[model samples]
Target: MRPPDNRRRRFEELYQANHDPVLGYVVRRTANGHDAADILAETFMTAWRRLDDVPAGEKARPWLFGVARRALANHHRGERRHTALTARLASELSAIQRQPREESADMDALAKAFEDLSDGYREVLSLADWEGMSIAEIAVVLGCSANAVRIRLHRARRRLARALSVDPPGRAARARVPEGDSA
Candidate 1:
């Protein structure tokens, strides 16, 4: 058997290798950086606890993603409230300062479009567009048939396109509109 220190070192190696992908997975599913961090921490915690169950080699990414999905679900369950995932994502994009102003504006508009999407549409878009998961993989993540994921993705894309086409509020309009106009 490997020494305890050797096993611990191996686990750290596996974790470090998978960290970025796992973080991306959490960020795509959650609304904000805070939630993403929470989910990521929970995912790694699960991994540490179930290290023996994680398969060796290339299959690790999928296994870790599965853990992330469970952690997100648990978060939602415990909170008993669901924030719009796209809204959270929008806030995250706004927090990134390195991008040019024009690029940030575009991202803000895209985030609004995403937020306007129906929950089904947002979920499909998050899985496919944000997470870069294949339709088959999204189907697995969502527990739906592949055809279902495809149909939802198609509709969601169309809706997002429509949402993006709408003009954003001007400064005057933003100031004048009642607080509940979009809400």
Candidate 2:
């Protein structure tokens, strides 16, 4: 049973005789070629390790088929576990992505409404609100006096606030109140 040269010779004979049948058995059970290849390797590895357990003659092929079947089952179980983990991670990722976006929907509406404003109003409001520019800086950019920039900024803000007032909150801010309905 512990004779090294004899053991190797027997395993080699068994492998030569049964490699194709065992591979075909595993390949038919698994979807992926790689999985089939791996299961085949594992089956042969098991046969080599348990050489004494392997039967002689025609019985040896059935014994190898049984080993391949079990290897294929183990491979399928591992695939199921991997698939379940990916799905759980995707669910968690989508939940995280949605939370911030839900909070920003109102901002999306505000930006949409802002787009409909006259260029002057948009410029003045963007400078004051988004760019964090001072009246002096805005006047220089607009080529207007500081007092004029102040007046334009104030008017732009009032107009924006009035525009927003008509918009139902938590809806697309892009919707416009008809000029007739601006009351």
Q: Please tell me which predicted candidate would have the highest TM-score against the true structure.
A: 2
Residue-by-residue lDDT tens digits, candidate 1, 33-99: 9999999998888888788898899998899999999999998776654456666767875677678
**Whole-model Cα lDDT of every candidate shown, in order:** 0.84, 0.86
State in Å the error of residue 95, model 2.
1.0
- The residue-level lDDT of candidate 2 at 73 comes to 81
* Runs with alpha carbons beyond 4 Å of true place in candidate 2: 1-3, 101-183
Q: List, residue by residue over 1-183, the lDDT tens digit for candidate 2.
A: 466898999999999999998888888888888888899999999999899999999999999998988888888888999999999989986865677876667666677778878999999988987789999999999999999998887777776766767533334556657877863
Question: For candidate 1, which ten residues in a row score worst on lDDT?
Answer: 166-175
Decoy 1 TM-score against native: 0.42
Q: Supply candidate 1's per-residue lDDT for 109.
A: 96
Q: Top model by lDDT, which number?
A: 2
Error in Å for residue 6 of model 1: 1.6
TM-score on alpha carbons, each prediction:
0.42, 0.52
- What global local distance difference test value does model 1 have? 0.84
